[model samples]
Target: MSAEIPAWLALESGLVMQGRAVGAEGEKGGDLVFNTAMSGYHEILTDPSYAGQVVLMTYPQIGNYGVVDEDAESARAWPEAFVMREMSSIHSNHRATSSLPAWLKEQGIVAIDGIDTRELTKHVRERGSLRCVVSTTDGDTTSLVAKAKATPSTDGRDLASVVTTGAPYTWAEGYHESYPHELGRAFDGAGTKGGGERIRVVAYDFGIKRNILRSLVHCGFDVTVVPAGTPADDALAHDPQAIFLSNGPGDPAAVSSGIAAVSDLIGKRPIFGICLGHQILSIVLGAKTSKMPFGHHGANHPVRDLQTGKIEITSQNHSFAVETDSLPDHLELTHLNLNDHTVEGMRHKTEKVMSVQYHPEAAPGPLDAGHLFSRFREFVAG
Candidate 1:
């Protein structure tokens, strides 16, 4: 079932890298970005945060451990395109249900291997993330380069619609299983409840991850996930005890309607946001958002909690960040990215709202920041 697939990745800067296609031989276009994590290719591929981007893994060899059902962050694979130096043809892992190549074919994601990813990453780091096209069927580098150059960047694109579900869906119970790790045992009481009533939580899916909902449900919250464009009034009609904004792709400024909805719900109910959700909250609070040159797209990012003065390694995937200088008086900065000193987390002084720019659920990253979920749970309980 293998075919000799020729492909070329053309960047907006007119730089073209020739390679061979591995998964779902086709053409795909997106903003090209790189990740530095040595592992967790499956989690990264399924992460909705990478919706409109062709993810390039800086760590050379990928797909060694293969794909596992339990490790999937989202319900479906989402990377528009995947780039790596080399993809392991033979997967080796006890929990692996299928190889990465097989999983990509099933999901219809275009992937490229046998390219120097480090050089490409270095190029992106110096020139910033750019729109690019990965073509497997087409070998005309000139036309591909032209198309890549003409493609619009992620600046004002409303890519959330592309990745979000069209209708509200309910996750059946028992979807999440517990695991014991260094962070301690999770889901101690899976089916049994001690005493307190189940907290009803309404999550607005602007490209949500399965892990986030699982984490909330594991914390005793009865979760109901809604679509991205669901109106604030409509969400409140559900009588949810808390509101959650899921991580998503594209610009926060482009999601003006969602920002407005969040503004209306501010101070009305406890709310928590991640990644793009965090940016939207800041925009609702009169702060501004700007696109990063290269952006952060890795699992080993370091973020310092200003309140506790403790640094936690986190998983991050975003191209836009909330401008700390433009934050309103009521909002307080809670976390800072130690690498770039960017605003990572914020809380409203007078409102029951808090958000973080990094993924605390950590599908492919560290669990050091899992306490943020506990903080959100406490906020909802109060």
Candidate 2:
């Protein structure tokens, strides 16, 4: 590997850290947040929900498995920068097409390694997410701190519009499995319908993940992905049997168009949402959202399913959550986060509407909540 260059990071709180640069030799600033997942660094780096933020991995060692195109959650990496304790120099995965640092440079992602990630994670845990700057081209801590503080805040920003797809498209791929037809759902090995019938769904692409589309297809839905700003009439023009709201970045309240569209779409057909989508749905149903001290960004969050009285280990990556007390009478809390007592899942009392704050697709995580897709299928069919 080439010799690592010097890099410096400065939080708006005036905290400074010195490390070695591994990715692009440039400067960048964003909201500094940490993720606790032990793996899936590639997916985390590419997740559009991380837009406008600098990601610091809590896991001590990252990039052990290297980078592969098939593992990317989106077409490109979205984080403003990547930080870690030790980015492995020697990646050993058989599927790796390129080393982590090499790919990050190629993608123009500014990154730093060999730092006290533990201290950084603890700081964020106690003080909430902070604005920060990472620079390999500059070493002045005072200047970096000022730049960090001057970085634009994600609040009241419509980032969903920034990351959403440019046009509508159809998705038909599913989970690549050894035996596709033998899974829970009856399928003809192609993720379509075996009996020549399939539920048609229109999914709002609020910076959606590819795995989610694959999961929907695996559950037997023909998905049509539309842009985030698509109006209610335009989405309904697809004549969908159900509507799906996808996860995204930034303040949910700022996604005004999405909330308006969802408000008009409610009760017309079955609807399901995930992550930011859940927050948007709750807002339309008379609830409110607030940013968490340190948002849930991990694979091992434990949640309780109120309807089943079962605990599920879920994967979550959101900085805002629905306010429990603000929920309207028309909606029922379906799941709760065991750790923080926050709302994780909810459903309409009378309509075919439900949503979860965690990712059920489980990309690079556990399979505990994957059944929610089938539940949505049953919900649409009913």
Candidate 3:
């Protein structure tokens, strides 16, 4: 066994928590946020919405199932570092190819364990998200705090460009793991079939999750994912039956290119957007957006379908939300978050465009929201 190295995390507000470095020995700093989910640490770490932030998992014990390539939301981890109360020393999972610590080291991510995450989380909840530094190399609290305080704000930055694909590509795979085939949908790897023709679909990738592509493919659509900045005419050139706008990081209004392109695509095709895509769509349609206090970042969020009066527990991760009152007369609210009564889903009355502020992909969340994908397919088929 190796000797445990001492470490510490210093918040920009001058609070310090001592711990031991669990992963790579390094230093990193960024906006601090917390996730309340008990599992799927891999997905959370790789999510592009976590870009330029240090994620502190509120769950007590983490890294028990180990790390697997099959569970990755993206190609690499995006968090500046990971914080936790305890990290499992032994990893035991059938599909895991590497231990979490080893994987973090390989990915050049710094992790710290042995801190009281509950207290830290409570502090963040009260004060809202703030700049923070977690380090294994530096122990000077004053210097670390100074560095954290000096870090730039993450809002309004074009972080989508940092994580989006450089060129257009087709996603052919479907959900192979994470749960059983209970959604009444099946994918044969190459494509999926749901009693409909293989409708060509254009997907705008503003840091999309793999399961979203899988969901579209499994719903019987041929998906072509273009960059976040792709123009409306270029996307329409494929003559897609529908268009999908993906979720991503940072302020939605700052993505000027996406707002402009989506604006042009409006009323041209059947459109569906999720998370950041939802915010962009709303902005283009004369709605307003504002940053939330602590932001929604969990899987157990309850959302209500206003049309059916049914409540669906969902998985969500976003810092900004669309103002319900700012919506245009043509836009109709479809879903609302039961926890905060925020806008969760919307659609233009006269056009085939709709969007949701929560992830229906359910990679690390719930399956109740999966019906939205099927509905999207039905819209395209009609």
Candidate 4:
């Protein structure tokens, strides 16, 4: 083992912290945000929704179980940099193919460890997420702070397009587990619960996660994924039974093309969206959205269903949310976050359109909200 290299983290607030370099040797900067999930660091790292940001795991000890190929949420890591209190060198897991730091280095993601993540997270909580820089190449605090201050924000950028798939593709794979036999569509038979013809769905890939596609297939939808820039007419050409808008990164208002596409497809098909998709859908429904103070980015958020009076713990990752006062009369509120009273879910009063601000796929979160996929299936059946 070579001697550990020193790294520095500088926030736009002029605060600087020193740590040990764990991943690639270089410099990177972005909006510094934190995730509270204790596990699923792999999923968080590969999640395209983390694009244009630096992720700080609130969990004190990360990488104990190591990295596995099957756990990746996307093809490549999306966070500009990774920050954690401790990056465990010894990893032991039956499915792991490589250690976390090794995998980060392989993916060319710059990372730092041994920093006081609790202090950093508290800073973000009190001051909101800030632009920051992480570097192993630069040891000067003044230089790193200057770079952090100069880092571009994701406020108005179309980051989804930066991570979206370039071409259309078909997905048939399902969840790897068989214990939950009712909700999984394996390669063999028609694994749908009802044993009927699968409903066709056109899913807009605005930085989609693989687990979402698997969840859709598991719920008996034949999914055809298209680029974020795909037009409504082109999507309608697929002759889908429903349309899905996926979770993504950055300001939803900046995704003007996606908003227009969803606007045209509103009444043509039953539509469902999550995260960035939820914001865009709300925007099309005459609702306004604004960036949250610190934003919600965790797996343990509690949401109450207005109709059922049930609270569901959900996985969420977003910086902007739909404004409650801006909700139009044509839409009805379906879910609200118990923590901060933010809009968690909603649906059209007449049209077959619905959306949620959290991840029901539960890649790195709980399975309490997985029924939303089935609910979408019900919308298609109706």
Top candidate on TM-score is: 4
Error of 4 at 122 (Å): 0.7
The TM-score of predicted model 2 comes to: 0.96
lDDT by residue for model 1 (146-248), tens:
8888766788987776777788766545234444353323333422233346777788888888878767766667788888888889889888989999999
- Worst 10-residue lDDT window, candidate 4: 182-191
Question: Pairs clashing in candidate 3?
Answer: none
The better candidate by lDDT, 1 or 4, is 4
Q: Model 2: per-residue lDDT, tens digit, 253-304?
A: 9999999999999999899999999999999999999988878999999999
Clashes of each: 0, 0, 0, 0
lDDT of 4 by residue, 164-248 (tens): 9999999998777622443342223432755767989999999999999988887789999999999999999999999999999
Model 1: residue 183 alpha-carbon error in angstroms:
4.6
Model 3 spans with C-alpha error above 4 angstroms: 185-193
Q: Candidate 2's error at 286, in angstroms?
A: 0.4
Go through the candidates in order and give each one's C-alpha lDDT.
0.83, 0.89, 0.87, 0.91
Query: What are the candidates' C-alpha RMSDs?
Result: 2.2, 2.2, 2.1, 2.3
Clashing pairs in 4: none
User: Candidate 3: lDDT over CA atoms?
Assistant: 0.87
CA displacement after TM-score superposition, residue 267 of candidate 4 (Å) = 0.5
